[model samples]
Target: MEKLYDHLITHPLIYVARDAERALGFDLPVRGYYIITSGTSAHRKLAKQFPKNIFTVEAERNLDTHELLRHPQTKKYISDLKGAGIMVFKNTAMIEKTAKENHWKLLNPPARLVNRVEEKLEQVKWLREYADYLPPHEIAPLRNIMYEKKPFILQFNHAHSGQGTMLIKDRDTLDKLASAFPDREVRKTDYIAGPVFTSNNVILGEQALMGNLSYQITGLPPFTDLPFATIGNDFSLPHRLLTSTQLSQYKKMVTNIGHKLAGYGWKGLFGLDIAVSETTGRVHLIEINARQPASAIFESKLERDNKKRNVTGITCFEAHVAALMGIYIPNASLTPLSDGAQIVQRITKKRSAVADKVTEELGKLGLNIVTYENNAHNSELLRIQSKKYLMDDHEVLNNLGEKIKNLLD
Candidate 1:
């Protein structure tokens, strides 16, 4: 990835930092070549990496300003960088506005397009019109009730990671659930009505670069035998879900959307969520995420092989470098890890005295344990807190708890 980035920097680069200092692990120094503007970051780390080839502007961290208005600090930074004719990466909504003010080129999804597509209702409408292959769903006001309807899913517009969602089976339960949270204004503010399913896609120019269907396997907690809901109510049995052929069909619709979005100057990574019905087998569009999905980190781990696929956390740094450089990457090949072999070996050594010896040896090489927790209970607490509020599936939480427990024990 560094090699690829080295090639891209020859054409000038823009670095938009959101918590840039922490993200890069250091401060940047200014000297020459390309223009770099700070968004959410306090300083430039690229300057540290390439001092002679980068210029920077520091942005303010004001939370009160309209996200589209450039804070005074950001405006000044943009002015300095633009005077030098350097491109800038604008991650924050305010900084994006600043870029437009100064005619600086930006690499991001267009805000209007993103705002439209990211809405749950709009996505469902768009998919129904364009794809015509989605499930039957009704988008009603949050306070509206569906008593005689079949089992259906509900979701909020701005929610992510499966928050603000529910599955309704009968009128009695739906009425009780609705009354439990009766502030119509609050419900409207928090969620929107829609179907639920997971979908992701990558596009470049007029082509679909990558697309795939994700299957979620869930289990019960240690004290229970019942499987918990993850994204939505789990169907009694697994269906074919979205097959590769269906993904191919959906690709055309996404390509069309991407093409239209490009008219607004969108050029980097984008993804969307999709839901399908079990009874009617209809597909329903959920919401679009204008930025990279959280799964992008894990997806970057997969690599193609000879007649098989593998998973490993290779090329993580490279992909980060590529995104920073604004390079279009089709695929990043990663090496697969051996099936628990290395982990087992390390565990065995840790059980013996050899673990201490290895730690001491590594310490001499400038490595040290930043932090460690040996108590299983404390470790479980940390794990639960990290995943709670973001996860609806108790099974996933339980599994994560077990993994942490195993590590501690």
Candidate 2:
């Protein structure tokens, strides 16, 4: 891993990416950019400031944007970077194939393992059998859950950021869902309300090197449609979102999952979502993200602001980069910084038309627009992101979200 790190300093880590610019705040000396989907106007302007190694190919939009790195256009982009180092991190068939074809060094977990973990059902099945903290859940074809009487959280077998999640309050929504997505696979889970939190862990072969926790922003009504659509994340003044036992339990759960993932050849950063029940105060597991999360960049930036050194003595960026490169990321103790919190706000495609206006208005209020897109049916649809500093007040962030929604409304 150190060899790759040293090489990347001069050779540059090639990124065949899509909306990957969101993670570039760390400045890892990455090069060979291939943004497959031309994102929103704000993001295109921001990404243009990307270092010289970037070569965007936004015209090719056939395959899903996440799968763009595997597209032929990416292959062509690599061919154009004739004399550069090839550092493949995203686990995709085209990426691995291209790397092997060029004899480039491969980072990230095995593509197969990544694909397996990305499935919502796979992790749910594992947790249902092994973990007792998650709410009672069931996975079946849409047909089976049609007559379910009690309210539950309805989700497609594969969807995120609120695209496939809903609160199944009654049969009417179910009827609508059946009519809309007759053939789609779905998961029905016990519904509980509380503060939703996200924890990020960097995993080696069988262990978590470090972890960070943040407040997950989801389903702020009017701004987003689904009851669980992800808007962004917040890390405000330090507070105990998790009890000592709950934190330990959460870490241990993540570590065990990490070990299991290691055995499956999975590596790099993984995230878990937990819903801290307002009633019982039990930290219940929701699901996992098998890749470096979009929120990591914001967390990393906050760490820099706190100026508190990680116990491992490695910066957030280094640990993440090293883990993917198959380098050892030593264990570290993390203390949640209490100075202030920052919010990463997202305006999804449903409200994409007002996205520019939102960012522009917020920019005047000291928040900077990060990135976004425009879409009707979510073709990397309009997603505008902005952040503001609060003295660790979750309410401040929530109020801001409400105000943003109202502005759009």
Candidate 3:
């Protein structure tokens, strides 16, 4: 295959991320390019497969990209590649400083802008024009919270994968939280029970290109115990859940939000979390992820697989790099592509490992597996991907999901 990113070959390239497997989309065939990730089972596997291209950090536990960049081994690796161009899964002051010190070009939006826009409270104002789509909400400290013996959603200033989000079901739960964070301000909104959806979008100058919309599987048992922890995404299943009108509304919301981010001088990829009310069928904005999303990796690979059979589409990963490189792509080619689904098995009390026999059995079923080593509860332990849908229309796991769950169990 010819070089996927010919232009990027001009400069040394490095992708710094928490999990190396997530950066598979950026594994272009170019010299002087490297992928830096924490040493997990997946990263070790990738390093063995792409010895010269993959670099793993030495750490006792799983760490995010920012921490990995600051590791002694990571610093030594960067020191050897002085002027390389770098891309990070998320932006942070530590990452920017390391890049600047080494004279490497940073290919992401400003950390301050990214951080400011991701705040749950700030999202209310940023998405003000579409206030009708927002859930009935109020901003207040824990001391002033009034759940009224009902379920509600409370979000803190920052968190990832739903850690900073809470689903308060009763007065007792609210009281406990209030006692724990009596002074912290939070965005309290009426609980809208519903199915969640997420989409990845790219911003280039004044234009924003939307990517695929997928059914966000969260809080599923056997995979995660945390009520809001993300499990995976099902691309093919969402069409069964959303009507054409609802899909159009989703696209419009994403495009407008992307434009708003661009107005802040932000560029490249950003993701949006959305919820559709089960009672009223209303769609609401959940939150904004101001950096590369977890879905981008498999979604981009899906597009690549589709292209092999004559399908014409551009992946968010490709567009992200181009946008950061100042390349302009016509809007027609940026349409979202739907082709596959991916599920994650997070480390939890009930499940910890997939037996070797089970792994062999799963491979025979055509499920691609990527394993990770982490002892922290809810850290990703395994990832399963497929070109087929892993869910049924009823929001339950289909044959594939059940098979994987059963095997793991």
Candidate 4:
């Protein structure tokens, strides 16, 4: 923690997120880490572990966090934000564009390096040099890719919380997707069949600290548009989550990716996508998220667990800020608890009803619900905060989906 401040003489970190707790945990003497978030649910509760840390920008349940910060109403915080030591964003092209437009002092990787990663083609191309761990993937025109003999998955390079992802089972969907979205530069690859996991990593220059691995809950409806949309992540159930060989292999892979990222000059949090094929018993590097992943909401919950047990747990975001500041915080990941744990789910529902009413209704049933007007979807995002591992249990998912869908009725 001391090392973080050592790098910057007077550069206070300005953390922007959807909730305050996501940005908390820098051991500041006087609220040095300012949290600029848009909203928190009743269940998406936030507690400032640090003393007197001021939470930001009066969150509206249905508003986007960054957009809220950029809104004319939030112009007051813009001045102080411009003066910060560094601006830490959640790693979207939108945020990068925001920084460029506002000319904020964002001390992450270059925007070009960061934006290139948002696309599947660029990520594959970057990691292609290190082909030992990466899955079999090819970058080319989708039209040419279709002529290959084997069944493959066509990707649009960039995706939003799994929106642009497709299983690509047949030609009909492939043609449909291409016709529907003709502009996206596509890549093709043989689908690696396995449970996909995200290893939250902190890359500090030439070094990459591999964080905890969490199984991604992908493609369940009501929570996502397609079956492939990542709705939640389960960090626990760690009993043999990966094989002995895989555990070591992927650690080395992340380290390799880290050293490679150093070449591009990125010292920040990233999610390394890995797929451990059940049939072949082999692990393969799938993709890379060059930003603070959506799975980071889990860290806020870990902070909650630490409070209950009276322990200090270092959150990835906290450590991420530290890493970017040239400090390596040991144990960036925390094991909170096991056995049917709370799976923090990020769900989106179309805006068909009053969002406040939906929140009120869900809250009445003791569901920690927060609704957001997603700029990507132009819909109300109903993030059911840690009710239970909805994906872990199909019954819960079914019941929850029916309940929310009933709201439309």
Candidate 5:
């Protein structure tokens, strides 16, 4: 373990993001690491707690991580941390240039590969060998796609949190998009009706360290309005929801997919969204998140909490950084996280009266809350995390979820 830290500390590890609170479960030593983020309550708290380690890059809420990095203050800070290793939730060509200019290492896959695998149509071709596991999907020009008057999943080349993925139910909607982008090729598939599941997997040499499978909480009213917009993840439901055979099948699928990705010289974390057919109980690969998944920090936090009680294993975040640094944990695997859940509250109303009071009450109830200010419409404004289950078998909010939802509503 000491050797691991020794190697890791050789170059400073800097986590650059839109909000500093997102680094809650990074579990890296603060002495040799830095957090660069925009001004938020959580970011302010971290600045006070670790004055020397947190740098603020104040910007408007709509600016993303890449845009935030362009701030002169952000550049000045990076200039001081020359030769540092940069880590981010996602990678971009601009970010890669930042690293090169500062003589720092970009702790992520090359932007070219990330860009290639991110395309919805390219992912289908890349994983064609495992086509049996994918939903019936085809890529064609939007104008040429035949709509059968049924709800179908339509996807563009890139998007996040279902932003570019749409459920087209009418011919008029299809025609509108077709008229807008006639040359655009879209990935169309049968809308698989079921709860979506996602996992964060780390690719090591010849192996994929599979993390816990979580029930993807998405499109729940009061949380998000977009039908497929991701809300959060329920770590407590997967094992109970999946049969023994289904569990085995999922693991095999992910392992094989990761192995295939390894042949492409890919490393570190990549996530997969799998949808199980409600009618047939069949698992279908929905999409690939070719970079670190959004849920990694929260999930890694659970592993850290388990560590305090002597639970042993390399955590997903640990494995992620190690993989990026070209370090491998021999025979490393994580203990499956059996219980816990998290949800995000998208900003629907500006400065709602309930925001402050609810965050206070929820904190009193032992729930962890991270808030963001000035966020764009429908962007995550608050995130609630709990060690207990928040949803029931039918996917409805349990008592905990209800409590949070009621307070916010």
Candidate 6:
């Protein structure tokens, strides 16, 4: 582990973390940059890998505007980081206020853009100007059955996860549910409501960096399936939901939309959920995620390499270090971990015996463990807490799946 730290000290990297004070301990005097993250533990891990050169600003909590602006550390960190900082929060209002007051750079879409694109009705209006590329969708008025169609998806713009989304198969069911929750504001139907489509776009500024088509598997809900399968098998897919040509066209549309958004002060990452009709193959714009996608696919892709053990996690730290130093990442694809490298499951106290059992089993199969977390010694274990492995990709993943299945059984 010390060797790993020593290697990182010599390499250029970036650190992004929520707490800058706590992250400064792992500083390395190297030619790198950093961007302190605000919400997730994964970002914290990135910050821990490169300490000294990183800059971080804390997300102001639910305090009053005056109190948040006056916090000593908040004032200091924000004043220091200035344009290099990134802040994420659930409340759009607070995010807007804080960013304005402190002059911090937001890594997600601006609040105004989110508010504009969140409602299905507003999105429909925007898409109407480009009707040739979009599917027909009607915005239902408060508890009103605007469209006599089955299998429509109703979306609430401000909802997180899949909270404000509903799929209705028939008008009767829609009426029954709508009747049950009559308060229009609180109901899902009151928000930007629409039918679910197949295509989605992940945009950087106004350019579509990655575009994916959605498909339903046998066992999961239509929309929920993508997150589940993409989580572990990020490098593989059983079917093609969108062709290369369609994806290219989608990227153009996303770029146009993003350009329009830039006029509204949107200057970061955002996800646009678009729906394509199964029958007519027409696309419809759904809603936009103002922040990072909850699925964590971006981080997973960044950390997917296979050559170096635990490269995904380490590269994340390196990337953060680079971002903080105001270094421009010329190519993001080069930083991703290699394909087919199964993320070795982390060993905790509860999983110690299980990890040992699996380690012994794999050794018998002639698979040499490249990295293993030593839980016996406190300090060494803490240093290598999240252990990863380098293995024969096929054999290791299949064996890992088997091990998990056997343990569960």
Q: Pick the candidate with the highest lDDT.
A: 5
Backbone clash tally (model 4): 6
lDDT of 1 at 300: 35
Task: Sort the candidates on TM-score, descending order.
Answer: 5, 3, 2, 4, 6, 1
Per-candidate local distance difference test:
0.40, 0.59, 0.80, 0.60, 0.81, 0.40
TM per prediction: 0.52, 0.79, 0.92, 0.75, 0.93, 0.53
User: For candidate 2, what is the total of clashing residue pairs?
Assistant: 7
Candidate 3: deviation at residue 236, Å?
0.7
Better candidate by TM-score, 2 or 4 = 2
Top-TM-score structure, candidate number: 5
Sort all candidates by lDDT, best to worst.
5, 3, 4, 2, 6, 1
Candidate 2, lDDT over the whole model: 0.59
Model 3 agreement with the true structure over 185-286: per-residue lDDT tens digits? 998988878899988888966778888889998888787888889889999877788988778888888878888788888888899888988988888887
Candidate 2 per-residue C-alpha lDDT over 1-409 given as tens digits, one digit per residue, 9 for 90 to 100? 2443565555445544556554453543444332333344544554577535454555534333445555566667656666544433346676677567666566666666666666667766555445566687777777667656787888776676667677888898898888877776787778877788776677654566556666776665454555676666655422445578767767777777777776666666778888877788777888777777766656666565544454224445555665665565445433344433333333444455544566578667555455444344432333334434332333344555555545656
Residues 50-147 of candidate 6 have per-residue lDDT tens digits of 55554333444323333443456556755654354444422266656766776665444556557666555565555455544444444544476543
Superposition TM-score, candidate 5 onto the true structure = 0.93
CA deviation > 4 Å runs, candidate 6: 1-49, 53-72, 79-84, 87-91, 103-109, 131-135, 146-149, 170-173, 183-235, 238-241, 263-265, 274-287, 294-409
> Candidate 4, residues 76-190: lDDT per residue as tens digits?
5657555674455555557667767776766666667876765677776666677657667666665455644456666776776666666677777677766766665687667
**Collision pairs in model 4:** 11-85, 38-59, 119-157, 120-157, 219-227, 219-228
**Weakest 10 consecutive residues, lDDT, candidate 5?**
347-356
